[model samples]
Target: MAFFRPGVSREAEVRHHADQEVGKSFGELLEKARGAEHELRRTQASRAGAAELRAAGLAFDRALTDALRAAEAAQRAAFGVKAYDDRIRRRKGVATPEGARWTAEVNKLRTLREENRLTGIARVPRPFAPAR
Candidate 1:
């Protein structure tokens, strides 16, 4: 016999809608992240000023985080909490192919960030202020 909880169904329905929205956003977020990554690469190759490189890195970080969040949400929605947890445990936090790719990108980003931090070139001017 299933326990009767009137609120449970409503909560599940809301979650379903939220998941749908997240699924829809995954593609857009991924595209934004890709664009940010490209910009960061270009800025690095061009040996841009510290401010520009820092800005690009920050933008890429934000975009990548957003994309990863959306992807995780979609995966959880598709797999359910228990199954998703099991998969994550089995995979060691990389539950899907997209997750693996994102993880690689994150690793690369961290390496670049560390290199810049070591070189003292990741500093940025005040937000919305003119770069010196």
Candidate 2:
């Protein structure tokens, strides 16, 4: 601390006041930097969460498409038609149509959600053997 000397001019007091103001400004800057750091962390976390959701959406979409394809194949095998014809439905009991059964199938490789909704073949699920 600079003691006030009898000879010290008024300029010393002015210098001391200026220094105090500058110190206060530095404290405010420190607070602002801390706030900015906190906000950056929060933004990063939100971005990571969004990325995971996008990945899940992609996974769900792929599973649904695969399921639809499998269900179509099962329907073809069950009803002997690539497309469901009403004539067949009228002749065969409603029980035979592929639409009446399996809503979802979960396997290790892929989740067969749509295939499960497609038809009866899922009910009698045969091990998926690659086409001979």
Candidate 3:
């Protein structure tokens, strides 16, 4: 039988997909934050003048705060969970027919394997197999 296995339900699959999308968005936001941090660091390191260094330091601080706030908001909006909270929960559920089909396919595979008592099947013959 195939290695495919019964998995999450349709509702669960939808929820999982949504969660993934939100995660990607959150990651993008984090990348922006990192860029801001890099800029701030560069400004501070430049030898142009003292005034420039001070300005850069201030901007860096503000950028840091903005990044943190953005992250918090994204997390709450995406997963409906607080950054400080130990546990997070999703507000939505999945609903996809494909999920159901996949689950059924997995169950069928499992049933076939049990009945056949087969470890595995391969198209290519083993080294010890007798030549035709």
Off by more than 4 A, model 1 = 1-8, 81-121, 125-132
Best by TM-score: 1
lDDT for model 2 comes to 0.39
lDDT of 1 by residue, 43-79 (tens): 9999999889888888877777777667656654554
TM-score preference between candidates 2 and 3, better one:
3
Please tell me which predicted candidate would have the highest lDDT against the true structure.
1
Compared with the true structure, model 2 gives a TM-score of: 0.31
Q: What lDDT tens digits, residue by residue, belong to model 3 across residues 70-117?
A: 443434334432212323223220123433443343354345334323
* Candidate lDDT values, in order: 0.65, 0.39, 0.44
The list of candidate 3 runs beyond 4 A from truth reads: 1-29, 78-132
- Of 1 and 3, which scores higher on TM-score? 1
Taking all chains together, each candidate's TM-score versus the true structure is 0.58, 0.31, 0.34
Candidate 2 per-residue lDDT, tens place, 1-132, comes to 889634434564454444344434433443443454344345455654544444444444444454444543333334323123345543353255343432222131133343323420112335788988
Candidate 1 has a TM-score of 0.58
